[model samples]
Target: MNWLVWALLLCSSAMAQEHRDPTLDHHWDLWKKTYGKQYKEKNEEVARRLIWEKNLKTVTLHNLEHSMGMHSYELGMNHLGDMTSEEVISLMSSLRVPSQWPRNVTYKSDPNQKLPDSMDWREKGCVTEVKYQGACGSCWAFSAVGALEAQVKLKTGKLVSLSAQNLVDCSTAKYGNKGCNGGFMTEAFQYIIDNNGIDSEASYPYKAMDGKCQYDVKNRAATCSRYIELPFGSEEALKEAVANKGPVSVGIDASHSSFFLYKTGVYYDPSCTQKVNHGVLVVGYGNLDGKDYWLVKNSWGLHFGDQGYIRKIGRELSLNLGKQSFIPLILLVRSQCQKEESLVNRRSVYKTFFSCMFAEFFTTFKLKVAILLF
Candidate 1:
């Protein structure tokens, strides 16, 4: 109500706008050179510079706010800094969850049983190197292959990177998977089972694009018999799976831009949607400064999010997509004969991988609780 108060507020706003880091250009130049970014035209360079600067300011302010306990996580300036939100969404998201999937299965192996307080598959030497999916919506493939790789190591005593491209290209026909566009992890597993086996990363390799299916059955290095699912919105179900099973694949809502710039700290945003859009792997879970968090392994390159990983709030991550109420919580289980661990009594496309192979090798193999990981 006073002129002095109004004048001070206006002056403060003006000062804020006028405030600019004098070393912005130097930092911008360094980033461009490091990322090998070369603009074709001057206008393009200027436009990108503006967007990149906006991100710098945004992340800087966010880190400050979160440090003060205003937020749960902090943002970072990575290779995606110059990219617009639309581009990030297009490049980052590729997970496609069927609106309707049988959800009548819960692998609750004695919930009252004692469980580990924390667990991480990477530390156990089961997880392969963190990979980059590039611009492919083939996150579903990466998620499936990541879990398979861990399982293979657990059973075989060797860490072998599996081919995601094999699923991206081949898993499309038998299953409803779209190579570069979108796909499901469960269907990918079924595809591998139906197809007999999947190729190793050395044999098939990843191109991060939809290419001609050149699958070689002789190169099949790993096989998965069955996967299970847990009840939606149940934290204990996932925690148990990660602790007992190797790594569990799951989906999360990555529609927010803040998720794109996510760097470190426990990611807990009320604004983050429950509509799962991207597929990821939950490698471990534990408490951080009294806050429960799930240690997630991302397909993005090592430059993004705490060295290609993020810690999501482990409380609630239920898929609320259109018409999607229940999804399987994936877990690995060993079966008898051809080892066709019974498919959860539901309308599933699960196929048995001829019981003649060395199913005897997997003694400690347990059930995989599915949670729409693809």
Candidate 2:
């Protein structure tokens, strides 16, 4: 409380504040450089303000444990920073069908099967690139395509990125794929097999919108012999299938705020419902620092989550598996399909698994500013 001590404290605080500003400035500059093209259509000043406010809120949230409990993860500003929960749901939570196995269809179940303590398809070089679905509720199409792409690589030693646009356009009538509005991955696979295959992503590039059926027989890249549904609520069986077969297309309740802001660590939102609202590909499972997690590949782009991926807590989503397997992708392709495009050239969109070294960088920067100014 002495005068000299108080003055010294104030000066020290000012120095600290000056120290923190540069770090935040660096982060803001980095974000602008990375995402400037995406926001170029908007007013640059307005966009910067919005981004700055969101980043501040993210820092506050990151430093405090929410009412839900101490989060096993951290969240920071991302492409979805400005959206509300309802907006996030409308754009992201698109899957509608209950993932229950059909009572009429005889399905295989090995609910008690043993699984590896950890698995990563990326390690095996079977996973494809992380893709962005934009504002389209086409997560089902992407999930199905991801599984099939991995299967293609596993079976034929060729990794071909299949087209989600094919399902969006063509699978509406008979297969009941609702294009961007919503659809089931099972129905998408059924449509692909029924149509004799789907075209490559390059041949039928994603527009992220519903359009008229543009099925090109000449450009068919891969086909499925059959799609199999894994048992509902069987985490062990799902793990076995994923470890032995390849990636499995699974569903998760993707409408949580925690999910929207997730940056790293094993995400477990106790409020997340068991209802399958959005579809994503489960590429593997593992434990980190005593926490079990399902490594999911999402279609929200590299700027979202852990670079377009999420490590959701295994127990919260243990029973949400559906349409877990895809047959060989090359089993039904024609000779013309093989020769028209080189699969190697088409694999340019490949993504390495994202590292979480940068999660603390933004939050720590913002927290320093808060401590200094106060």
Candidate 3:
């Protein structure tokens, strides 16, 4: 054998030996034990730091208060790294959510409301498996596309799966980002309105990899004819809009710790107070135990939320911090003239009198004097 071939073989053998195998570990038990030890140690340190060093009697009375909740499962140190299904579920259940959390609130649903039925798509049907781009904060595109796709189904009666990847990659508006970066849903909606509509996944499949903007016009799928913006922070108004219209695009905050650790149906995030990001969407209001709840669908895969959906009520309003912070989208139901009818009539009367007076020099001079006296 040649010396070069022998050397290459030796190197290949070494590389094979160094390769590591990937194994799945159930780490929920380990997390529970680790948290137990850390909690005890931290409590002691906190007690000493507060009493002997600071000369404080009650730690709670101090200017800063720490509220610690128990964790039944261990959230792995890294994102999506070796967390067991049980641990994820327990973590979601053990969340210390506020009693007045938005999920518990209710809104009135209009009986005569029109909603998207199964037959809206052209012939394709409703698309499933839309995924969430976590931490990257690109929920705005997801929300906009989610509603847009649903609207297409309602109109065409075909369940055609739309591509969120196209919006995230192609939209170059105020709220759009470079795939993984953050963006706002309203901006994405505006982008769609201005640029016709987005393409289907079949036309442009998702790579899960961000690339340069390369939109192909022939692949475009659907277009939005009109968008009805609804009021923010007013559940009554939003519910009414949903009932009257098909769905209204909305934005909400989803940065709570529980939101990140969610793994099951039982949502219990104690730190629901801290919200960090915003997402947009379509809504369907319904009743549960005589209380109203917003049936929110998410772009994340089916494993998250209630099968890629969330139930929020008035208490969970804090989750909509972004919605509250900005001006709500308002869709005009009445004509502009009708909305200002009295003012328009008054302006018309003034214009008629002014025009008549201006046609006559003497009357114009008299009007000037009358105006000065008034």
Candidate 4:
């Protein structure tokens, strides 16, 4: 039989059965047993394909099945809606994330700090609240604009939501199929900076459907005048930028089921290290149980993370490997205090001042010599 045909047959067999909690409906077990032979025979190849494609690792699938079983067991005990602490713990424990980094990896001391409550207004409340991108892989644009929006609010004290569609359609530095493939957030940031800034969502609404780029100079889709790169993905650098300068752009590994399944608080999915899909911003950081973690704001939606925030600890270096390699690229903006401070604080200040005076004295002396020669 053709592999495609066999795969289709297996999928059809699995889809034919309804998935219900066995405890809620006792007949499910009997149904499973009756159809078990036929189901296995039909879907064995399909299961193998899923395993070979790395979409469904054996251990992870096993854990998911175990979690479902426990859910069924809880339902039998009339604790369906309200799971016991032990039961909840057991279900959580059954979560097996493949491609987890070794627990013994050494961690550097994180120099990042928390965002002041005063500046909390700059954070992206949720990605779901913003326009959707559908199947378009313009996640990088979404992330870049999302961070820029917050940064603008932080710097200007004005809350104006920017458009991701603008960056998707307008950016020329990168290439992809209608923004459906992928691109880097850094490139998008640079595009925004060079172009002045992007427009407000109201000015240029998002067409979740892909279309031709209609560049309207009047509305001028929002743009940024500058981009300040940080010294690596230091949470401290991010916090300092937010507190002192403005909100910063950041990237992270978002291509995991755990990211989609995130409910509340910090999520440390061992699987994040495997597939790094999404990029986001680190707006804040906080200490939990004497351990420090970043307050990552994602562009997926409010349903993801702790209301759109993920706490990542310094120990989990695997998820933030790219951040560790960052070389700070601060946009040079003229600040009088910074400029004056730079001149007065350097080691050669006295030397530079005396050298300028000595040059002036020589020019005066040389002018007299020239007059004498004439």
Give the lDDT of residue 100 in candidate 4.
Answer: 34
In model 3, the runs with Cα more than 4 Å from the true position are 1-128, 173-176, 263-276, 280-282, 312-318, 321-374
* Tens-digit lDDT string for candidate 1 (1-374): 22322443445444455444557979998999887788755545555676688889889999999979898788998888886666666666778877777676646655686988888888899889899998888888888888878877776678888899899989996688889888888888888778867888899988878899999977877776666665666667667778877687788887766878999877876676667778888888888777778888889889889989986554443223111343333344232322243443323323333332233323353222222222
- Candidate 2 TM-score, C-alpha based: 0.72
Residue 236 of model 1: what lDDT? 73
Tens digits of per-residue lDDT for model 4 on 204-285? Answer: 7776544566656566534443454455445455555555544445555554444443444334546555334455555555
**Regarding lDDT, does 1 or 3 come out ahead?**
1
- After best superposition, candidate 2 residue 332: deviation in angstroms? 9.7
Judge candidate 1 at residue 149 and give its lDDT: 82
- Candidates in order have lDDT scores of 0.72, 0.67, 0.44, 0.45
| Candidate 1, poorest ten consecutive residues by summed lDDT | 365-374
lDDT of 2 by residue, 1-374 (tens): 32322443445434343333444666666665767634332333343344355555664676477435576777867777655455667776687574444542223445565667889998888888999998778998998899888877764678888899988899896776688888888788888878878998999999988898888988987876556555545666567667766787877777766777787777776676666678888888888767777889999889888888986555444424443332111112232333333343555312210111122212322433223222
Better of 1 and 2 by TM-score: 1
Q: Which candidate is the best by TM-score?
A: 1
lDDT of 1 at 199: 89
Residue 18 lDDT, candidate 3, scale 0-100? 39
Q: TM-score of predicted model 4?
A: 0.55
Once superposed on the true structure, which residue ranges of model 1 sit more than 4 Å away at CA? 1-23, 41-43, 312-374
